[model samples]
Target: MNGMLPWAISFALIAVALAMIFAAIRLLRGPAAEDRVLALDTLYVNGMILVLTLGIQFGSRFYFDIALLIALFGFVGSAAMAKFLLRGEVIEP
Candidate 1:
């Protein structure tokens, strides 16, 4: 019903999308494994942000759930990758 909120959301969505794109480029072109992992983590965070913003715009619980899942998996994945980079193993036997 208001014009300003829609514009604000649109701007946020575009900004998040651009962040995701930059993260993706970093993931692809990073010189170090840690840099790539950081980029990947950034991508996930940006993705989660985009999802939440979209949820706010659309008033959808589904988007929130998806964003939560992304956050969980992204954290787990970053931890695993960090472990692997440090010790060459995600799960030590």
Candidate 2:
């Protein structure tokens, strides 16, 4: 069971990495700012998931902290981008 776990995680990590790469391509080639932002958000999410999968595969807790930080920053950045798109500015002042 233990040996199987690492293999499963490795597969999942590879899948997520592929998805993130696709998302990055979309972000770069997107025709609109909104599309780029959405792709970037997707990339961030996939990256966090990949981090968690790595943590599981290696039996380490270190990646979890990095994942949490990535998620936090991703959320904040997405929110700011959305606000700017909707109102033309991220902050009123």
lDDT by residue for model 2 (1-93), tens: 458877788799889999999999999999999999999899999999998998887889999999999999999999899899999999999
Runs in model 2 deviating more than 4 A are: none
Deviation in angstroms for 68 in model 1?
A: 0.9
TM-score for candidate 1: 0.95
Clashes per candidate (backbone, < 3 Å): 0, 0
After the best TM-score superposition of candidate 1, give how far the Cα of residue 1 lies from its true spot, in angstroms: 4.8
Report the poorest 10 consecutive residues by lDDT, candidate 2. 1-10
Evaluate residue 10 in candidate 2 and report its C-alpha lDDT on the 0 to 100 scale: 77
Best by lDDT: 1
Give lDDT tens digits, candidate 1, residues 1-93: 669999999999999999999999999999999999999999999999999999999998999889989999999999999999999988998
Give the runs in model 1 whose Cα sits over 4 Å from its true position.
Answer: none
Q: Could you tell me the lDDT of residue 12 within candidate 2?
A: 98
